[model samples]
Target: MNDAAMPKGPATALEHFDVLIVGAGISGIGGAYHLKQQCPGKSFVVLETLESFGGTWLTHTYPGIRSDSDLYTFGYRFKPWVGPPIATADEILKYMGEVIEENDLSPHIRYRHRITNATWSSRDNLWTVEAERLDTGQAVAFTCNFLWMCQGYYRHSEGYTPEWPGMADFKGRIVHPQTWPDDLDLKDKKVVVIGSGATAATLVPAIADDCGHVTLLQRSPTYFIPGRNANELADILRELKIDEAWIHEIVRRKILHDQDLFTRRSFEEPEAVKQELLAGVSAFVGPEITEKHFTPSYRPWRQRIAFVPDGDIFQCVNRGKASVVTDEIERFTEQGILLKSGQELEADIVITATGFNLNVLGDISFAVDGKPLNFADTVTYRGMMFTGVPNLVWVFGYFRASWTLRADLVADFVCRLLTHMDEKGARKVTVELRPEDKDMPLSAWIDPENFNPGYLMRGMHLLPKRGDKPEWQHSQDYWREKEELPLIDLDDSAFVYAGTKARTPEPVG
Candidate 1:
């Protein structure tokens, strides 16, 4: 976030671009790259609210912060990830930085610019977006033919931490994983980490050796699958002296295929998958701890399944450096906490690895033609565009697969749409539900009741819905999307292609 590099004092003159992307994270970078290569003539700029980029990679600095999934899937498709498949936060950040620098994307990024509201004028056929420059608190205005939301779903500023009784009274230092202080010394301190998600799993083992001990307190069990952090195929290829490009391609496909198989089995035969997953955990933590702290009540993949490298968390617990407690918190004492199971735990510090608060489109209020935009009143078209919204695409990745896989897909798709609109001489394009669709029943973005993860369940009301038709549905299956998304039919009746020029707004203050 080079605020000094930006225009000082009050923002003067209006900034207009062919496209405006409301994020400078991984997805935003990918989107910008696609826009540059595919839609060469389209002028676009990425606006980041933060002082810097990398999104979550930049925000979270927790002890054991790392990618929950392998890096090959998480990395950009166009870029080659030569490092280990699973990477630490810093390593991933460096990788992303290299991508940004190599592609020369920094010039197009405006950091510390937070979008406040977006108004789409149908008569003018453009979006007037208002943003505040964080450094100077000065308002800035921009107009674009299309607005791309690459800001991910989570609230970057605040993470979800449940209220436990006596939390405030506890004398021990309290911390949330999202906002871990760099200078907070945890060395030899008895730590109690609350929650059993991916963050907690990573944190327990990460600080186990240095800290006095870590106790992962969870209300329920979560499934874990152990795998090597590095790709064996990549190693084998290197040993055989294969080309780096060939090795990357081969190993990338292998990881994707393996994950696809596991996901397929989890959906098709959850019981068998559950047994196999628990068996892996049992091998690491032993049958006793597996039964007590690893066996979840729900079916496998109902929530996300975590990946463990060499069963590190279990190894730490077995070595007495860390422990896991499956119990509800009754109250937080100054010394520690009281469990609902009539057990008390002593702690000098507590870390809440609770989930995140979901924020859609960077929490930017939206309106079209002077009427407020209600996401619930619209249907998703190809999981990207909303029925009533014109020339906007939300880059939400797949929950089951690697996030960047969908990011690449979305970047490509948006580029194609822009190219199509240009060729059609369309001034303003809007996705309006078909006349027959009015009779169709609307459904939630996803069935939170079925696959109820905390973030998704809590934010269901804020998300967009889907119609009954295939085009309106959001399919989480990446393999299916791989085959279909690139071939999007421009002639579909779901979109209105017209030659109306976008309206320009008044000058900015």
Candidate 2:
């Protein structure tokens, strides 16, 4: 039903649905597509906060923004990426649009509807979802049997701004990458970029050519690796007249395996290897820049590094188009930024590429019978679903591998679960890992201490232990996921389903 015809205000009774998906991002879309394919007649709807779709791809409009992962692995397996390796934001957005249209998914989406809270009712076995429309500010509610949360970690609509003293007093215009102003002209103007994460590294070199001088300010160091933006392997496969599906599979496997190997070696080898990697970054930036800032005490991959093609960031620094400052920010002055070492640097514009605000589970509060959920208190089961939350599933992909790879697996798993439920006459199903299964050490790639508001941390006790073999393990290996999630049957005793006749009603008239 269209927004005008739908009921307004609080919905007291359960408005039945087979599935209710929050956030229309990659994960949500994947889930919806799989659900529709598996259960054609099932009633489902996707509630998106933004007026437009594409989730992060639509919200993040920062300059030079692009996917860090290669498209061969990053893009959906069902839909081949008919573009360059590392896709730009606009290209990715267009691809998402195409996916929605090609699948005829527009009718299933409720745009501008932001879910505010969801509470599960044990007696009725339903979740009451409360939401508000961004454009109209009118509240609405929906009740569904299954609630799938695909809201990503980053708060796409908001930017993270640290409380730097006298920040407001700075005479120059300050901007954050999340909310970059369109009218602000930085041409021939001195620019100071704060933070050393992916955003800063990418932005520094990108805007340097137009600006007079660009200074990258950082408090700590991050690993800087480089990769080609265009996939040579994909091009070669295409030239060889290989099948499109075969080419995608081959390239995806190769890249995923190579990344896994590199990550393993970084941790398994001696400290010298980590040092050597850091030294390589230092060498690329030159000793003068290295001595001033390139050295970070943490090991490689403690946090993800900012990547570029052919050492672009270093090249910009070497050409004197940009500079680095390792000093801590003391305060912002009317004319410039004052450093802790009693030094100051003047700038016409200040870009706080500091970091993202991680809003885990899309900042939507959840409760079971009015008892609010403390996410930290509950354990994460399979790094996706939580223990104790019934008839719910979540999509959480790799921090190391391409997100879509695992997302595709999770989508397939959901479809399998739905099919099983239908065949067995089950009303609800909830999957949780065994308690003893949480002791295994997780991949070192995930940051344990970094507790930004936007970040999502799976507690040690909540996550499943790594399996002995790669197939059963929580590895980001695509072949492993294909074997474990897809090929495996959904008859495991751990996933209990209530066999009842209370199927979700059709969409409201």
List all candidate RMSDs to the true structure: 2.6, 4.5
Q: lDDT tens string, model 1, 1-509?
A: 55546554555577888999989888998899888889889888999998888999999998878888888779887777888777898998898888888888899999989888999887778888988898886788888999999999899988998888998879889899998888888899999999988899999999998898889999998888887777888989999999877777788899889888988888789899988998998887788889989999988777887788888898898899998899999999888999998899999999988899999778888999889988877789877888878889999898888889999999988888888888888877778888888788888988664477888888888888887777888878898899899988877887798755666556557
Give, for candidate 2, the lowest lDDT window spanning 10 residues.
450-459
Best by TM-score: 1
Query: What's the TM-score of every candidate structure?
Result: 0.95, 0.87
Off by over 4 Å in 2: 1-15, 270-284, 287-292, 432-482, 487-493, 503-509
Model 2, position 417: C-alpha lDDT score: 74
Q: Encode model 2's per-residue lDDT on 157-260: one tens digit a residue.
A: 67877889998899999999988888978799999999887788878878999999999988876667665567788889899999888888888778778877
Candidate 1 has an lDDT of 0.86
